[model samples]
Each structure stands twice: as structure tokens, then as C-alpha cells.
Target: YFQSHPAIQPATVVVEDRAHPSTSELSPTWNRTDEWYNYRSNPRERVHVLAALDESSYTGGTMNGDHPIAWCQDYQGGRAFYTGLGHTKESYADPAFRGHLLGGIRYATGHTQADCRPENGYRPLFDGTAESLADWKQAGPGSFTRSDDGTLTSSGGMGMLWYPGQDLGSYSLKLDWKMASASGDDNSGVFVGFPPSDDPWSAVDNGYEIQIDATDVPEKTTGSVYGFRSADLKKRDRALNPPGEWNTYEIR
Candidate 1:
């Protein structure tokens, strides 16, 4: 079906092998160990993929580890796609699943990209700047310190520093952020498509938050389209690096 559709051509596919010990090895108990049994050796591995999706529901789950569940880094000015949905034969055979898969392929292949910018727009209030850090006074005592590497670090508050002189709606915004640890709650994100507003809270309720929490229960973890969608990736047992170790995240 994908080959015949030129709109979906030029695609890339990834498959995870359960037979591999890293993912296939079984533990005696489900609760104590970080493995699920029923779907352990399913030829297709459907259960494993579904479990990852289900975990994407809250905040923290199997994703708090150092390893990334799954990722796609090839950007060619088209759509980027991923799916932890290749675990079972039945899953592959399902029409609904196929439809979504095909749609993603088409979109990623540049068959469809939405255009939704306002003709006359509001200017952004906080262009990421050293000065914008001053407005964060009321968001609950936070401090910004210049790192040896020149990246500004903030503690105990929530705010955004827009890049100075960045024109809205023309260029895409990208940045890397990670939690200080793997088990505690950390709140931060790159706010995009923000409308000029007096406070950051306005952006929280209005714009899109590319969430950066490393300890969110499940559905709210790193890479999640906060409150709206989840990244389709696998669950891996890897811990985030120690505090002060930088983890790079890019959003465009």
C-alpha cells in the first residue's frame, strides 16, 4: 500500500527484535522486575509497544531511565514519524493501524503540512534575553546563573527567555533540556507558537509546550506533546545522566 502511494514513498522503517536479550530477557516476577510477561515473546511484540503507549498516559513509568525509548533524528524538511506498534501480526494487519501509519508516512514525506499562522500577529513579550529573566520575579523565587559553558541555568521558577530579535512565524524554535535526576519531579519545556502576553502562565494555557519532564509519571514524560499527544517509541531501561550533565533536546 505504501509503495503504490507516491505521496508516502521515500520513507524509513524501524523494527525492534524481541529475541534480543536486552528486550527479550525475562525476569521471574513482573512487579519487582521491569518486564511484562504476557507479551514477552509474542512473535509480533504488540503488548510491549502498547505498554509504552499506555505509560505515555501519566508522567513517570519505564521512561525515567537513562536510555531513550525510541527516536527519529533524520530531518529532511519533511515529516518525522515513529511508532512502537510492530509487536504483533494482528497489529500490522489492522486497517486502522495501517491507516495511521500510512498517514504519518505521507505527512512526513511532505504530502501534507498545515499552515496556520495569523496574517496580523501579536509580538512576543519575552524575547529570550538576560533582561527577560527579571520578569520572572513572581513565578516563585528562581535564580539564573551563567554556566561555564555560557548556557543560562534557572532554579526554583518557571519562565521562558525568548532569543533577542527572533522574528515570530518565520523560523522554527529548537533547544535541549533535561531533568536533574531520574526520579524527582522537574517542570520545564520549550513554549512554541506563543502569543504575546503579559505572563508565562498565559502561554501555559494558550500555546504549545514541548514538555521536558524526565520524571513525569507516563503520558507526560519527555518528548510528549503536552496534554495532546504522545511520542510513539519503545520503553528502554536507561537512566538520565547525573545532575549537571547536559542532555540535548531539539524542537523545530
Candidate 2:
């Protein structure tokens, strides 16, 4: 389903799946030289694209307008991952490239957990823009402060910042977050499938919470469906980055 171009080319690889372990630590736009491959058909419809070539950055690309360089999927009940990187000897020597390859192997080997199903129709709920922030309202004691960079940080909270927009159903929610404290003890959570109520406890009592504290017990720790179920700790730990680094959460 693919053929390589004749010459080595330099291009920027735009990361499409920040939540995937393979591309989590990578730059949003990674510049490198490699033998770009042209697939007969776009694999995005069949796989979860991890990263792709910025065709505009290089000449002689053959994928027309879209070029996927890395992707992963479940093929006949087995995990399959592919990347068009590492085309040169120097690529293996590169630390970032090595980590990328290792992470892919880990996922394929079932050492880590990632949602590799084909993702589609996801729209931003909070895209680090003030205009986008208009859809949310803060309730309770502490309020969230929006920084110039479009990140909202909770200053104090016995309360929650919630979406006051239309009720959602059968949806997926994704967001990027990081701990501000160096201690790695700070805790927060995203409550889902909750009913509309001014009291923050309404969410706690009515919906499921995807916990965000790394140091808590399994049932209340990171990746846990708080008070309901604990994530597979081994996979959770393997997939999670250390505190202070940005982490993406995809809750469906």
C-alpha cells in the first residue's frame, strides 16, 4: 500500500496524536530528514495516525495533500504500528527517534495502553483561546485563571469549572493538563456524564470521575474511574509521563 520516494528529503513531521506514548514527548512540529513514503491510500480511515509529514515543507511528496508517516491499529486482533521515520542511520542515534521507536514497541507489546481506534469528528471544547473559554462557567469557592498562553489554572478549589453549554451525549472529551507543583501530589479530576447542577457535589454523586492524582490509591489514582474502577496500573504507569510534563487525556 506504499512506495518510497527516490531521494531523502527534509521535512517537518506534525504530531497528530499527542496522547499516544510514541509521540507524547515529541514536538508538535518535528523537523527531520528522511525517505518520505507515499501510500496508495490515506491510512487515517483505517488506523490512528500518530504523526504525519508536513508535505508543504518538502518537495516531491506524492501523497497529494495528506501524508501520514506514523500510525497504529488493531489488525486481526493483534496490534500493529508503523512509522516512516528511521530511514537513516542517524535516526537510530537520535534520542528522540529512539524513544519514539521504543514507545511504539511498548504499545504493540501490550506494555502500555492507548486508544488506537480510528478517531474522528472530535471538536475542541477548550482550545486555549479566550473565545473558546466563553462556553464554560466556574462554580464553587476557587476560580480558574486564564493565562496569556491560553491555559487555565485553578488557584483554589472546593469548586469546579464546568461547561454550561448544551448537554452532551455519546461523546468524546480530550484535554491536555499538567501538575503545577513539583511534589507531584496535586490532585484534580474530570467528571463526565454528570447532570447539570450548581453544586459541585452533584457531579461527584451523579457521574463518573476520571481521577488525576498520581499518588493516590488505585481506585482514586490517575486513570481511575474514581470510586468505581481502577485502571490497569501497569499500563497506566507505563503510559503516564512524570509530573510537570504535559499529559493528554482522552475520555469517551
Which candidate tops lDDT? 2
Please provide, for model 1 over 144-197, each residue's C-alpha lDDT reduced to its tens digit, 9 standing for 90 to 100. Answer: 665433245667656555433444666544333435555536677777776665
TM-score of each: 0.40, 0.72
State the C-alpha lDDT per candidate.
0.40, 0.83
Worst lDDT run of 10 residues, candidate 2, spans: 239-248
Candidate 2 residue lDDT tens string, 82-189: 998898998998999998998899789987667788877876777656888888887778988887655678977688989978888887787777776776677899
| Clashing residue pairs for model 2 | none
Once all C-alphas are superposed, what RMSD does model 1 give against the true structure?
Answer: 18.9
Regions more than 4 Å wrong, model 2 = 4-6, 126-167, 175-186, 193-208, 214-250
What is every candidate's alpha-carbon RMSD to the true fold?
Answer: 18.9, 4.3
Reference-based TM-score, model 2: 0.72
